[model samples]
Target: MKQQSSRTEEPHLSNVENPSRPVNSARNDVFPSSTPDNSSGESATKSSKSLWTNLKFVRLFMAYALATFGDWFDALAIQIMVAYRWGADPLIIALIPVCMAVPGILFGSVAGALADRLHKVRIMILCDGITIALTVGILFAPSPAWLLPLLALRAMMSVFHVPAQQALTRQIVAEEQLFQASSLNGFVNQCAKIAGPLLGAVVLAFFSPQICILINASARLLSGAVLWPLRRLVEKKEALVTDEHNEENQKEPETFFKQWQQGWKYLRHTHTVRNTIVFGCLGLMSILMVEYQFTTLFREIKPGNESMLGWLGSSVGAGAVFIILLLNRLPRLGYGWGLGGGYFLIGAGIAGLGWVGPDTSTAWIIMLGLCTGLGNGLFMVTMNYLLQKETSPDYVGRVFGIQNSLYSVVLVAAPLAGGAIIRSAGPSPTFQMIGLATLAIGLTGILFQRMLWSLNRRSTSSEKVGSAQQGVS
Candidate 1:
C-alpha cells in the first residue's frame, strides 16, 4: 500500500486538476477528433441512433434498403407476369438469374475499385437515380427480353452500392457497436423482403406489373430525398487518393483491363477478403437452391401446404427480426456458432420436409420453418458482420463487389440446378441432397472455428503489442 505503482495511481490522478499543464490536454487525451475512443461507456448510446437520429448511417442504409426494396418488387412482379403471361419454360426461368448474374461477373471488380475511389454516398445516390430511370423505361416498354437486362442493370448498381454502404455503416458506428448496426440493418432487410413480396402481390392483385414498377420507382425517389440530408454525416476517408510523398498511391490513368487487373491483384493479396467471397458463393449456392425450389416443393407436400409454406417462408424473416432483438442482450454468444449451427438446422429442416407424405401433418412444416428461419436469420446477419469487420475500410467497396458478384453467380446457379435436380431425380431426393450439403458445410465450419479463433486471438495480441510500442516510441 505504501509503494504504489504508476498504473495503480493513474486512475486517481485522472480526475485531478493540473493547473501547470493545459486544461484541455486531459480532454484531448481521452477523445481524438479523428477517431472516437470506442472503449467509453457512451459508445453504446451513440451507436443506437436510427436514421432520423443519425443521418450519416441513415443515408447509406436508406440507399441500400431502397434499392433492395424496389428491385425485389420489380423482380417478383416480373417473374409473376412472365409466369402468368408467357408460361416460362425451365430455360426461360434459368435466363432470369443469368441476367441478374452478368453484372457481378462483368462489372463487379470495377465497381469495387470505384467504391474505393469515389464518394460512396454519392455513388449510391446516382445509382438510385439510374435505377429509377430504368424502372421508368421498363414501365413504358415492357418485354420479356428487357427483364433480364434490367435485372442485370440493377445488379450492377448493387455491386457498387452494397460495399459503399457497408463501409459507410462501419465509419459511422463505433467498433463496439458494429454488431448492433449490422444486425439492425440485416433485420430491416429481412423485414423488407417479407414486406416487399406481400406488397408486390397485393399490387399485382389490384393493378398491373407496370403500376407495381411505378410504386417501386416512387420508393427510390423518397429514398434519394432521405439520403440528400445525410451528406453532412459521412466522413470520407482519404486512403484511396495519392499524395506527393506516396506516388505509388496515385490513381494511375489506366485502361479498363488494367484497372480490372488491379482489382484482381487487390483481392488476391487479401487473405481473409477472398475467404468471405468464396464462402459466400459456396454457402449461398446451397441456400439459394433451397430458397428457389421451396415453393414448388411445398406445393407437393400435403394438406397444410399453402398455410405451412407461407408460415415457414415468413418465419425465417420473423426469426431474423427476433435475432436482431436478442443481439443487444446476448453479445457473448458469438455469431459464428449461430451461423454454423443454423446451416445444420436448415439442412435438418429441409430433410424433414422430404419426410412429409400425403398422410403427414402440416404442423411439422411450421416447426421446420422455425428451425430454418432461426438458423438463416443468424447466418445472414453474422456473415455480413464478419465480412465488413474483417475487410479494410478503403477496400470495402471492391471486396463487396467481388462478394456480391460471387453471390449472384451462386443465386443464378442454385435455381437452375434445383430445377434440373427436381426434374431429373424428383423433389424428395433433391431436398435430401440440399439438406445433406448444408449439414456438411455446417460441420466443416464448426471444424474450422478453432483455427479461426486462434488466428484472431494471435492477430489481436500482435495489434495490441504494436500499439504499445507506438505509444512508447
Candidate 2:
C-alpha cells in the first residue's frame, strides 16, 4: 500500500486518458470537439446514434481509445517498479509527474501552435509513432531515474498529439454533436480506466512490470495503425473545406511566431478559455499535490496487495461511467453546475480517502473512489465542452497548448510539495489538507460560473442590439 497511486495520476499523465496534457495532468481525451449552439433541434431518440453514424469519428475514437488503453500500464509499472521494486522514497515518486510536466512548460504552447500550423492528423500520427519508441524505452529503463526521462519524452510527444487530436476532433464531429462526442470520448476513457487496470492487475500478478510496459507499447503501435485510414479521411475533408473557399476566402499565412502569439492573445482576451484554464489548473494542482501518495495508504490498507491501486482506480472509473450514463440522459446540464458539483464531490472523496486507515473497510474506500469518479465525470466533461464550444476553431490547438503549459507549470511544483508534505506529515494529513484546498477551489468556481454566465448574457444581448440597430438604420 506504500506505493504511489497512479490511477488518478494517469488521467493527466501522457499514458492515461488524455486532456490538458498528461501530467493529462488534469483531464484526459479532451482530443477536441465541434459544435452547433445547441442540440435541441436534433431527434431526441437518436442523440447518440447520430454520433455513431460518423464512421470517421468512430474510427478515430477507437484508435485513440486503443492508444489510451496502453496509457494505464506505463505509469502503474513505473510507480510499482519505483516505489515497490526500487524502494524509492516519496521524493522519487514525486519526480514522475515533474518529468511529465516539464515538457508542457517547455513545449506546450509551441506544440499547440504547431498543431494549428501543421496537418493535425499527420501531427497526431507522427506523435503516436514516436511514442511507440519512447514507451518501449521504458522497458529497458533499469531504475526510477531512467524511467522518468522516458516518461518525459513520451509526455513531450503527447503535448503535440493532444492539440492535434483535439483540433482534428473539432473538424471531424459536427457542431451540434460536440458535447455528445466529448461525452462519448470520456466514456471511452472511463472504460479504459476500468479495463486497463483490471487487466494490468491480472497481468502483474503473474508477470513483471516489464511485461505490462510491453503490453502498453503494443497498444500504441496498433492505435497508430488504426489511425492511418483516418489520416487520409481528415486530409481529404480539409481539402474540400479549402476548395469551398475562393482565393479571397483563403487565409493569409502568418509566421509561426505570429500564430503562436495569436494563441496567447486569444487565451488572454477570451474569458471562457481563461476561466476554464484557471479552474482546470487549480483543480489539477490540488489533486496532484497528494495523488501520488495513495500508494502509501494502500500499503497500510492491505499489506502485499499490489492490485489495490488498480481496484481503487477501477472503482473511480466505474463511478465515472455511471455518471456519464446519467449525464447523457439529461438534455441540458449547465456547465456551472457540472463543474462546481464536480469539484465538491472530488474534494469530498479525497477528504474521505484521507480518513481511511488500516481499520477502514474496503467497501468504504471503494465508495470514496466512486465519489472522485463522479466528480471527474462532471468536471472533465464540462471543461471539454466549454473549450470546444467557446473557442474559435482557429485557436483550438493553441488554447489547449497554453492550458497544458500552465498545467506543466503547476505539475512542476505540486508533486514536489506533496511529496514533502507526505514525507513530513504522512499521507493522511497531506490528503486532508489538499482535499480541503480543492474543496475551496471548487466553491470558488461558483463565482466563476456566475461571471461566465453574465458574460454570455452580455455577449448575446450585444449581438441582438447590434442586429436591431442595423435593421433600424
Best by lDDT: 2
TM-score (C-alpha, index-matched) for candidate 2: 0.79
Q: In candidate 2, what are the lDDT values of residues 185-304, reduced to their tens digit?
A: 788778876778768878889999899899888988887887777565433122211122222233555588876876776665555567778877878888878776788867765677
Q: Show model 1 residue runs off by greater than 4 Å.
A: 1-52, 86-90, 231-234, 238-271, 303-307, 456-473
Write down the worst ten-residue block by lDDT for model 2: 1-10
Model 1, position 77: C-alpha lDDT score: 79
True lDDT of residue 470, candidate 1: 29
Model 2 accuracy (lDDT, Cα): 0.68
Candidate 2 lDDT at 95 equals 72
Overall local distance difference test of candidate 1: 0.60
Model 2, 67: alpha-carbon shift in Å?
0.5
TM-score of every candidate relative to the true structure: 0.79, 0.79
The alpha-carbon lDDT assigned to residue 135 of candidate 2 equals: 83
Question: Model-by-model lDDT, in order?
Answer: 0.60, 0.68
